[model samples]
Target: MPDSTAPLLLKGYAWLPDLRRRAHDVPAVPVRLLGKRGTALHGKEAVDFFYDEKHVRRHDAMPGPVLDTLFGRGAVHTLDGEAHRARKALFLDTLKDPARVAALARKAQEEWDRAEADWRGRDRVVLFHESARVLTRAVHDWAGVPLPADEEEATARDLVAMVDGFATVGPRHVRARLARKRQEGRLARLIGELRSAGLPPEPEHATIARAVAAHVDADGRRLDPHTAAVELLNVLRPTVAVSWFLTFSAHALHRWPEHRALLAADERHAWGFAQEVRRFYPFAPFTGGLAATDTEWGGVTIPEGSLVLLDLYGHDHDPDLWPDPYSFDPARFTREGVVIGRDDLVPQGGGDPAAGHRCPGEDITLALLAALVPRLARLPHEVPDQDLSIPLSRVPTLPRSGYVMERVRAEAPAPVG
Candidate 1:
């Protein structure tokens, strides 16, 4: 197989889909990535195959660069089997509760409401950067991290840097590493203080920090301070990363102004719009796991220990699954009685979150979007002259202008009936 590391890096989200196109839409494409033979699989059935623990495992699958920047060393994302389940339970217990999710969303909405007023005073504001600050403040409060008001913007920038730099080997990657180091050190110190004798009691709703600090692993041992800090960041980083989706939401509304009225008038329409943004936008390109044993799927054999990547971006855009897959239509998700299947529409990973490596924060992502995007649609603002083109060749790409807007004003509340 030809080495595709350069092509994958260069092509970004277009790499796998382009390879499949060249192979006449083969079910699986054999190629080399990072000097290892990798099989890229697409479609719903492939989702099932890739997520099966009997066939593939996450241990050692993520590269060292990814571990240092994105998922910390010894984080739950790197575990397998019983150990994974134990660590995952902590996330599920805290993040999956309805009240907690609502609290996080409410905090985010509050931040957005406050920031909207501030934006009106400025000549221009980058929605992407501003949204990151909003989410950073919200998640910090919701996660019980006690960040000072002045540090929120810098913290948000670091969190964004971690996500922005994880997939590349350039200056962004270096920034991500430094950001992770700074956050991990700060968080580890916080964890130590929380564990010390003089700390106040954990609040009723602020359970994330306390829960992580006190969690016992499958081995019946508490996580080391640094590891606990990593897990805490596992919660913080992804929540703030929603800024990417929110930025994309701004792009969608700018490009298709017709949807704005529907989204602003009806909350359900806003939710549908959020789901479409998740599906249509380019976020995660693909995710990989190593074959635990020899596995066969789509008539192709994946040798044991070989890399197997599930094509998330391709599957979301696959014509067989979505009618007019290229169209930016939200109505496809709004029809009555429609529900997105677990193994389908995986901008995050697929399968039951409790049982698989799927992101436990998926619901949090949707909830934040549900709360914020509607506010964005309703806000009175002008999409100023800017480079709105979203280049596909950049991993984690966004509009070149960061979706700038000006002349911001909040809409008046509807008169009570």
Candidate 2:
């Protein structure tokens, strides 16, 4: 625990001692950078720096990190200008309507309903992995692929491992690569089927895998299949990467029970909790980069090619940006839940620090969580190890057994006079 003193950024304070302090000076404020080797960024200042386009270009350039090694540098996340827009455009047709999202949500709800029914009156059942299993199947179904019932967790783990993008230290890097391989194998088979179908070459085909396949050099040609394989992996990579946040949001509401009741009883609270959870439990700690050119930040000059990381967790907890930063008050989001159209509180880790990024999928995550978290809370059950301590490091993690939740049999409400 390095000092969180004046003008200093600590290595990782995911368990904030003074969330108020974070809400006070975050994002834009310069904190002292603790010199920890092979550490990921974990401060609001880092978030701001990460959001900067110039800084994003820098993040796009750095090597030895997670996503870069998977796709070599400059996939959609790294590319810029027309090239960026063009590549990104490939997914437009596939993602155009919200119908797919709605159907997926409905599928998820049915599963949650089933989980609650199965766990009624139980002590606790591990839910983190279970929920992952549920949502992964929903997304897999949307992708027009068959997701075997038992393999959902393994597939979800593989997806989470790939998007974790934490290569370079610990077993995290090794695990991520292994997960990538597992996922690549699964996606390869699916792609083969798509190829055999000979469907129209639209953006639907240009799913993340398709986009990677279609990504040509400046000359507008196709990339090798190996490169395309990584892109296919990318399609669902971040989906699971962000799932933990939704899972944590569900855990927070359940562990706190008050939020559960509040959300269930009030439409306003439901919407507000939706926003706060994303702010409070974002999965990505920060994005990484090396400056392309000299840049100015927090009154300090960053020399060309210095490593920069944008910590999304820190930004959500900014003391100045958010009142009682650590407190889980959802009122700040307003009724109907504030749509996250590039505000200061960015959890998806893109856009300008004060502006926005390419986090188009945020709505999808939020909508699903908004629907699911409240329902999961009403399950009338309790998880035994609700107090299982998660680390406050570069990224938050859960134990292998995963989280448990028991169904609490809801007593019939008395009739009101």
Q: Candidates' TM-scores?
A: 0.97, 0.77
Candidate 2 regions with alpha-carbon error over 4 angstroms: 1-62, 68-74, 91-97, 114-124, 163-168, 201-219, 335-341, 352-357, 398-401, 407-417
Worst 10 residues of 2 by lDDT: 30-39
Model 1 residue 10 CA deviation in Å: 1.1
Give the clashing residue pairs of candidate 1, or none: none
Model 1 agreement with the true structure over 177-295: per-residue lDDT tens digits: 99999999989998898778343344334468877887889999979999999999999999999999999999999889888888778888888888899999999999999999987
User: Which segments of candidate 1 are over 4 A away from where they belong?
Assistant: 198-206, 413-417
In terms of TM-score, the best-performing candidate is: 1
Native-structure RMSD, model 2: 5.4
1-417 in candidate 2: lDDT tens per residue? Answer: 353422222334443324325555332323233332122344545555555666545434545454533443345566655565565554443443477566666876886677566567556666766666666766776655567878877887777665554533557677777776677666666666655565456644433444444445554865445455555555465555546766677657655767867877876676578778778764555555555567666544555655555556666776657868878877778845444445467766655421334565666676677778777666555556555565555444543335665556763464799
- The C-alpha RMSD in Å for every predicted model, in order, reads 1.7, 5.4
RMSD score of candidate 1 (Å): 1.7
